[model samples]
Target: MAIIKLSVTERRRLSAFFTCLVLAFAAWIITVLSNPKPYVVKEVLEFRNTPQKRAFRPLQSDTVNVTINGTGWDMLFSKMNSAYKAITIDLHTLESKSYVVLSSQKDQINSKRESDQQIIAFNPDTLYFDFSNRKEKRVPVHLISAVRYQRQFFQSGPVTLNPAYVIINGPASVIDKITSWNTDTLKLDSIDESVVTRINMQPVKEGNLSLYPKNIQASIPVDEFTEKVLEIPVRVLNGRNIGEVKIFPQKVKVTFTTSLSRYAEVDEDFFEATADLDLWKKNGYKTLPVVFSKIPDYCHIIKIEPRNIDFIVKE
Candidate 1:
């Protein structure tokens, strides 16, 4: 093997040549990207000025390939970014015709976009729609939620919505299948106090369906809960003809959880416990099981002192 070493001046010249070569390559790239050209990108379709008197369902997909005439930089950026703004299409012409030609509205669509980047054309140049009878109805709004409460804290009452129902207008076939609309999921953790906020409804997936008041006001009542005990007398049931009925335990202690606001108001009157005599006569059971006929709303029962009672009937 032979070792050859170059002079310092020769190495310096080599470095300068390579540096110029790299700079020239970069300059070429910049110039190419700065030049204007036509590029194709996919855009979602947004329909506006919908005919109020008719309902329509698009026969094709809601996406279209749009040819945009702009600089090379614009093309590169549009390809890099996945969230392109949707193209708005006017549907006022639909009142007379069932189809729309995109070329006819090129000027109008271009007006809403950046002046430098113009929409040259779009694939699926023609959009066809299926028409049906329009129907409007009011449907209840259902709340979707996943909440965790702090210890001894919980929802005190039913959640209330400012506008309990929303108006939905769409094709009769689609409207008939929809009974209610749902709000986006309300997620909360370690909640201790009441909540009041505005939440958006789940967006309509079908292009033909429309919802008014896309968002609603939600009021959630929350409170701290405590244990409440009450001694309720057990009443005899289905023992009409079996005149006198004596139970070993006449009353039972009921323990339950109730909100602080309602703790004092809740008492024996709020609950009803009864022992059915039919279990002893027909079922041939020796003891009668105590059952609750009524209980206050939102009150959770913990335990009953005497679940089964020994009763004797004197005929």
Candidate 2:
């Protein structure tokens, strides 16, 4: 086998070329690390391990400013395109604490760091929170309806709700103060049959509170009703130095319509028909309309036997 060897002059030239290549690479790295630039970024604060029996509400702010320091090469080569970032805070260590000082531990504030970039500082050095004891309570629900019943239709009884009350769980400061909850506004016109629908509860828009069963079933009991005539007595009063006023009829036949369930509840005693004598004293009108009051909500007034009454003052 024959061996090929370079001349001494050629060997020295090749060695110098290799040395210059290594020197250029070393100088580039040294320049990159020598200078560090600062940049500011914002991130959301995410809380972790929140106590099951307590809620921590932000009293100051929910965002923190982060100051990062990194080399020029690190900034260009690393992944700095993170659009979203969150600083998760562990609450198990807080333990019924109102507030805590942040920046105490670098591990607490976690985020994406590009290359050799390091977090220099945070805008908020401390975090403030309001802690409250959690509680559960049962509160009644009310329905808000804009219903126009048919000509001969009415509500049989109170509107029945699938769940009479909702079990609410939240901070004692909020749960203990709530007595009842109402549903969203419902509109129904010319309703002649039963209505059933699911409605959302009024949300707790403020404070640290939670509502169970965000939506509930609502049922309205509707049925056909008949008209009934009742003889209600009339009373004339407010006569002072105006002499005894005698109404032509002492009783009036009041006609009203009510559902079958509430038909028995409607009677003459539940109605008030009166002829104010003050009208005769002021203008001396012989015929005056009888004012009817105390009409039951379940019953709709159909008509009165005699809308107007004739009266004579006996001096």
Q: All candidates' TM-scores?
A: 0.84, 0.52
Model 1 steric clash pairs: none
Q: Estimate, for each residue in 1-315, the C-alpha lDDT of model 2 and write its tens digit.
A: 998898999899999999999999999877865678676667677665656677657787677887767766555544466664667666565675776566765654535544455677888877777777778899999888888989888786678887879987767777778899888887889999989989888876543566778888889889889989999888886866767778878888887888877777777888898888777678877787889867876778889979888888777
Q: For residues 1-315, could you state the per-residue lDDT of candidate 1 as single tens digits?
A: 998888999999999999999999999999999998899999999998898998999999999999988988999898899996798999999999999999999999999889767999989899999999999999999999999999999898999997999999999999999999999999989999999999999998877789988999999999999999999999988888877889989999999999999888998989999998888888898998889999876688999988988988788
| lDDT score of residue 211 within candidate 2 | 74
Q: Kindly give the number of clashing pairs for every candidate.
A: 0, 0
lDDT of 2 at 290: 89
